[model samples]
Target: MTSAAVNRRQAMGAGLGALAAALAGCSGESGPVRRLRLATGPEGGPYNAFGQALAQAVAASGRRIEIVPVSTAASVNNLRKLDDGSVELALAMADAAGDAVLGRESFPRPAAVTALARVYVNYTHLLVPAAGPVRSVKDLAGRPVAAGAAGSGVQVVAERVLRAAGLSDTSATAPAPPPASAPATERAPDPSADERPLGLAASVSALREGSVDALFWSGGVPTPALSELAGEMPLRFLPLDDYVGALRERYAPVYTAVTLPAGVYGLTEPVGTIGVGNYLLARADVPQGVVRELLQVVFERWRDLLREVTAGARLEPRFAISTGEVPLHPGAVSYYRSVYG
Candidate 1:
């Protein structure tokens, strides 16, 4: 063929190839896959176990979900991460969610997070070595205690209880006398010595070593570590019944009268305490479809989930909407109302 004919044929072939490529792009069958990220609490914690169960359910939905383990300061940090988009989902204390949304306590600004469900109730647990003298909140006034790690929901509640009990870090060890030359105005007001702040692990160690008098934990009933500790060491569960009225008056409405049943960990009697629910939270900006699917998976596979953790058995459909102050996510609301209503 002539040169001109050959050039014309090459140009036509190139145009056909470009047309094919465009058609392939518009096929729509080869779409990108979506992934859901769930942020769980520190290793071996209830939040972590719950998160793993949730991730499993989501994965079983024929969708992709990844459970990410996070060493958090508990509810506060979890809410912050969810708001900032660092995590799409997280577990938080219902009270903490309320506080964060209202910008109360440690929250400097309101967090843009929404609740999916109230998963389970967390009990305020005060554990002392079985052989120790610490028997109640009043008994701990001048004693060393573990108030939970900083940034944890446990720490916040523990501190609130201490303040309610008229105790402080310095309440147990203040010097007996002020300087002779100091002005009267400079005199300390009830200078009680400060108690050292111990983290969760450190508190456990302290108890084992007999260095600390007691440890305070705010978590779901039958916490694994607490159960394990009870088996290994003689431990006592302090009752919060005496201060229930005061605790309710001072804090959010999360605190409720409850009992730790006898034989939960071979206890001789049920421990009376105030309780709060644990909530599943998500960023306000998460795609509505994703949240809806996540909640759907949780409810649809409820039985399987119940087997994953002890707390799972408590996630009833009616209780899913049990959150008080934190507004339920619209997506979750749709799912809950469909099932419960």
Candidate 2:
């Protein structure tokens, strides 16, 4: 062949290859690698641990997709990240997710997000010093407490729990001492509860230092940090079942009465508290195939996830599809249907 003809043929081949690459990128096809950002909770939290485990297992599966876990304040913050396009996926409490869909609480407007699965249940933990005078939610008046981190689902629930108990945010109102074990009817809008927004580690530290009398956290049973803290000092978990009724009556029915069985944190008997489902969320605009594939890996490699999350029960289709109020992504719907069939 003539030298000029040879050069022209090579140029045409290169142009075709470039076009194919562009198409693959747009379609998220097998020709290119796909990296997705997953917004998780702060370090040492269940969401963060689950995200890391998920990323590792998915990588070992040799799939074309790569999950990158980003740590934040959890739930509400994670949802905001997903809504703003900073992250493609998020781990959120169902109560916060429902509030996001309704454009309330931490969310300023309706978030464009959908659930991939209801991953697990978060047990509301209200930790108080064993020797402290705060025996019930009513005793929290005028006492400083760590009410989860700012912009977190834990914080959202903490606020609701306080409201349900007829207490007001300490940040908004002056602290005043109330009688111990005051009735809810008498506690209406009591501004004496001193609530401080702090994360797991900080809250544990504050509690240990006697800076805070109580701490509220929501996570999987036996959160590693809290478990370790329990070993160092005798702590007590305040029962919250009473507040769940008012929580459901005033807000969405996302709160449930659940038992924190004995042996966790060395309790002699079961502690009744609120339960909220944790959900894996994604932007509503995410491709259906991507969500489906992600769910496939999650269900198949669930054992690996369990090692990190300790979600009490096996990750199953029936339980996963129970994400109330927050609609499932179409891809998740398709995946669930396939399993049932």
Candidate 3:
């Protein structure tokens, strides 16, 4: 058969599986349709955008599962919802996921969650005014900075980056005073950055209004809100790749060096920055059959889904299985075995 014929055959098989699942769901208790809540990020953010698209795609694919995208504060909040059994699927930064699994950082205890796939890479973006006094990460000391929203993966990484840059007090969630043993000269500058917990849009507004000296954001290249802000004002991106080694050494080894290519947001040269993987996660108890069917839609219809996500994201099955440290859901392992074998 031709390639097109094979494609049609595969699509038909998937549709049949969905139909069977739907019929099975119907046979039991004339119950409501099987809906799974997906915890996404703040409105207009990458997580929410992609989650909405994925939910729509699943609906269009005639799957028995209805993915409802729930707007949230992003990674950390999403993970808590999963811990409490409020959501089945969530999008999270790899660093946050690793921390949750190991009971590190914000998580007081290890969380029971499993990965479905490593969906994409989020570039750490540190936006500053072009003519501002803050030229580098170290220059952020004693300045007002709009860190990411409280309980967001962006905040999680932002705090680490600040600590690596020796601005320990810039952390909004957990701020600690400089050690008393340290000499005055060796301590951080007199006053530390005033860290505010602001979401993407609010951060952009704060930056534009001169209320904050810099803002930290983690998202796909050319995050829509930031892009719009760039058009309205002259902006400079501070490099974060310099601290990747420190972040990896102190925290989990989830940070990688990545570049935002030139011409994006009117840049004249590529900017090296820190990168973190984003994962599609589920609670440990999600049904195996449900996960299997969901993975079918995610993999087979990934091209359509990609158009809805960040530009540089990779959704291929080969890359999807690289959820380091966080164990893969049994259904995800089964799906990959079927594809690879």
Instruction: Indicate the TM-score of model 1.
Output: 0.82
Candidate 3, residues 1-341, lDDT tens digits: the string is 89999999999999999999999887764545678999999888889988988898899888678999999999999998998899999999999999889988789999999999998899999989998888998888778899999999999888788877767564444356689998888775544567889989999999999999999999988888888999999999998888999888877678999999999999999999999999999997888878988999888877777665678566887789989889999988988888786
lDDT of 1 by residue, 1-341 (tens): 99999999999999999999888886654444456566666666767777777767776677544445565667878888887888877888877888889988779889888888887777888888878777778787657778877667787677767776767553233345578898999977542313455556677788888777888877765777777788898888888867777767866577788888888766999999877788888877776766777777777776665554454355677788878888998888888767677
Global fold similarity of model 3 (TM-score): 0.86
lDDT of each: 0.75, 0.87, 0.88
| Span of 10 residues, lowest total lDDT, candidate 1 | 189-198
Candidate 2 per-residue lDDT, tens place, 9-107, comes to: 999999999999898787764646678999999987889999999999889888778999999999988988999999999999999999888888677
Using lDDT, give the best candidate's number: 3
RMSD of each: 4.9, 5.6, 10.8
Instruction: Rank by lDDT, highest first.
Output: 3, 2, 1
Weakest lDDT window of 10 consecutive positions for candidate 3: 168-177
- Residue 307 error, candidate 3, Å: 2.1
Off by over 4 Å in 2: 1-29, 170-191
